[model samples]
Target: MNNIKKSQLFWASCLALLVTSLSFGIRAGILGKLGTDFQLTATELGTITATAFWGFPLAVVIGGFIVDAIGMKRLLVMAFIFHLLGIVLTIFAQGYWTLFISTLLIGIANGTVEAACNPLVATIYPDNKTTKLNHFHLWFPGGIFLGTLIVILFNSIGLSWQIQVAIMIVPTLVYGYLFSKLDFPVTERVASGVSTATMYKSVTSPLFIFMFICMFGTAITELFTGQWIDVLLKNVTDNAILILTLTTGVMVIGRGLAEPIVHRFSPQGVLLISAILAALGLYLLSTLTGNAIYFAAFIFGLGVCYFWPTMLGFVAENIPKSGALGLNLMGGAGMFAVSVYTIFMGGFYDRLILKKLPAGANEADYLSAAPGTEMANLLNEAKNAAGPEVLQATLVIPIILVVAFTGLVIYMKNKKKEALTH
Candidate 1:
């Protein structure tokens, strides 16, 4: 502990996470541009986006298994290499497959950063795992806020998407340098002398499995909507990216103040409340129009702000024996679910818009129609109608979460009572 540079390592992890999140934010901002430039459909764009989610689980689950053996520094190095390659590839991406591969690389980098950092933070701050983890995770939405602002700025100035992506390299280099200079401590599992078999067993426990299932809902409720905000709300709002920016901005504040909040409510209680707010927010966004969308965005942000870190923290604190594997598996499962859901949402959106088209009209007709022409206007109206419907359909996720988190709260309460009685 004395030899390790805890502050430097933790901040470096934040910087690495910033890089990961900037990719998400920037990608969200550029999806429209990519679609137009490459002549891609909603489904194709979704596939490219889904690669990032799917690739995340792949790296994270594998990294979780091997992080203790390979060392945190090594994983950080892998993240750096992958990030550099991915960003470069994306800058030069010609079409679908190239975009898919590049985004996958970035996703892998993102997951590796989480694999190394989550356990690293837990090990370093043994006493304040949940609160500090929340604090550490603040950079996620913080970076997204910054990334969205950058996109807005760059777009206003007529800059290329390549330039928007290249900005990521600055933070990537800094994190790589900072991580290289630090000495990392062993994971909490290793430090506590928790055996590998015990960690494995704990992750497979009923409690862990329940949380794993719940993660699918929580993650999609937050991430899928965030990633697709520009598309989902484009028709409903004048600037959908602002909704993303505002949502992430709210998240930055919420996560920053998470210590007091988590102290007051307990992580489970907070999650339960978050799910309710998120459900309400999504429903409002689907049904509302005009300036009301910003209000809904604020609510959505508050609901999801604590979700990721709090989920990780709960596991770290209550299921201490599960170690890094549990944290990574939770994250992996969430991302994997989002990957599958993204494709489904994309296809669903396409179908909805198609149904809105007049009889015998198809996507090709809308695509070939000249801008502002009657056919184009019809297509725009259909998109406007379809976008909000997608959001309306997604409301089911958080509604379900309300029930699941309620169960979790009840189950945790009973566990506490049983512990005190024993």
Candidate 2:
């Protein structure tokens, strides 16, 4: 009825994120089913999964550049269309190419949501980027938690996977309606008339570059690990859905509670602590078992809950001149890292499975390795041992982040003191 309210746009954005995250939850939940039905290997599945991550950066970067020209509303509309189409195609996906192309479209839609919403939030709440961005991102895990439960519920009732996916159509249409009549805002960069050259310059700045590079590790730590929760925990537990829900549940709650922490500590301070917990959590997941694994997952969720949004928030606050391009590139860089790691991990899992199982093991044989028996014990042992190895390798990224973010914390601390003195 009136011009768009920031609150209206924010919830619309949350719904968009919920759709994106629900896709991920559904994809993760169906990994085993997809692999079995399609007769695919881990390497093949990884290749398919990589499409989602690959398409995101491409769209986000391009969307970043054109968002100001086309308007955020139009960009979001495109995202909605893509989201709808991607889901339809995914439901009908018959094989590798079909799934890949469908997922790639969905990935683009997901990136579009971030490209539009990240800057949208920053523009609307300029004074509180970190805290608000954290709040804005809370929906990501919240969606995942909800989606996982939906899948679990559906599975318990012998529902089809297609139905699980089709359920997302509800949120998709709701967001489309919410955004349809609302007016949109001009981007922060455009309102300020930040020159194109200035945007590029900010992107190339050393600080921006440092943050960009660090995003790769942070993205992989959260997304790559998260996207594979079902497969990774398949041998560890019967309720992978519950485990997925639990990890994301912790993230939802952790992020929900982040305002006070963000208030007390600087974003860098928060990031520093997050990196420590992430590394420790990954190691624990790799090394520990049974109940301890759940604890480790909670820690890991807390570690990553702030990384993506806070990184964007930091760039928004610290690199105001960079504008939408900076935010888009940060998101793009993270997804790109996720794409690379997904492929690498998938291939690694394929190789690991080969080493563990007999040379000619088939899908039935693989699935037959039950949880409590000898073959299952061997399978679980192999997964636990090999699984942690990949996680341990990933630990190197956060360990390095610990050092880099510490330097950032000190630098920001000094910068703040200098401002106070001035």
Q: Candidate 2, residues 1-422: lDDT per residue as tens digits?
A: 23348788888888899998998888888877787677666788888888899989988999999988899999899999999999999999898889889999999999998889898888888788888888889898888888888889899999988899899889998998888877888988988889989999999999999999999989999988887877776655677557678889988888888889988887889999999998888888777777777888888888888998889988998999999999999999999999999998888886676577656755346655555777656655666556656677778888999999999999898998999999
Candidate 1 Cα misplacement greater than 4 A, ranges: 2-4
Model 2 TM-score is: 0.93
- Top candidate (TM-score): 1
TM-score of each: 0.98, 0.93
CA lDDT of 386 in candidate 1?
95
Judging by lDDT against the true structure, name the best candidate. Answer: 1
lDDT score at residue 117, model 1, on the 0-100 scale? 92
Q: How many backbone clashes can be found in candidate 1? A: 0
Each candidate's lDDT (Cα)?
A: 0.91, 0.85
Task: Flag regions of model 2 displaced more than 4 Å.
Answer: 1-4, 359-385
